[model samples]
Target: AQSVTQLDSHVSVSEGTPVLLRCNYSSSYSPSLFWYVQHPNKGLQLLLKYTSAATLVKGINGFEAEFKKSETSFHLTKPSAHMSDAAEYFCVVSDGSTDKLIFGTGTRLQVFP
Candidate 1:
């Protein structure tokens, strides 16, 4: 049982508010999780990752996620929202089952002026 589910399909925020994206996952073994962002017409870029090293991990663009093993969750958050931060985000899970990363449906963030 290795999979991920992004709770929000879309999130809208005003230009200076906080941002939160929820994700839940299940894994048979110890797993590694990742968050990635993709801008329009651009490839996906790594935001942050957690690999059994730390429960709280920080990524680029003021993004961070906490790996809660008991709850099987890895939710991403940002201190403040920016118009440029509008993009699609994906929660990923991988346990060496394949060379590819298992991606969630994705959550699209919309920032308004």
Candidate 2:
């Protein structure tokens, strides 16, 4: 089976501080991993993706994630957190079957000044 679990449902961070959102996944075969960010009332934008090519993947908005097969984790991180970074993020996984993507419930990022 393939699934994704976001460790935190909500994360609070100060402006300009580093941000970290944890995620874990399980898959039967080599899987494709993705991070997506969604602003209020807006569609999801692809932050980054891991397709069995690279372990360290970089995305938009100064975000990045490392795919660790042994740990079964793909945690996202950023050096500086911005007010605009305050939004919902979803860790996604592809079952290696089709284009269908399974999304985690979501993690709300709250940025405080």
Candidate 3:
């Protein structure tokens, strides 16, 4: 079975400051990982993904995550954050063999000026 744990339930950042959301994963097999973001009343959006190709995966809106097998981590990071970046972030894990996905509790980002 594959699972993911979002270390932080909420994260707050000032505009223009860096943002970091921590996540740890456990998988029986090589897992496919993803970071999804959802704004208030908006649908989920794919921020980035890791599919065993590269350790460092880049995605839309200047967000990126690095797969660290040694650390069992896939932490999301951005050099700077914007007000628009505030949202609920989820860390998802898939076994790559099934459609089933395990999602973390999510981390809500609050961006303030």
List candidate 1 segments past 4 Å from native. none
Which 10 consecutive residues of model 2 have the lowest summed lDDT? Answer: 95-104
What is candidate 1's TM-score against the reference?
0.96
lDDT of 2 at 87: 96
**Tens-digit per-residue lDDT, 1-113, candidate 1:** 68999999999999999999999998887889999999999999999999999899999989999999989999999989999999999999998666868899999999999
Q: In model 2, where do residues sit more than 4 Å from their true spots?
A: none
lDDT of 2 at 89: 97
Clashes of each: 0, 0, 0
Candidates by lDDT, descending order: 3, 2, 1
Model 3 residue 23 CA deviation in Å: 0.5
lDDT of 3 by residue, 1-113 (tens): 78899999999999999999999999999999999999999998999999999899999999999999999999999999999999999999998798798999999999999
Report how far off residue 4 is in candidate 1 (Å): 0.4
Cα TM-score per model: 0.96, 0.97, 0.98
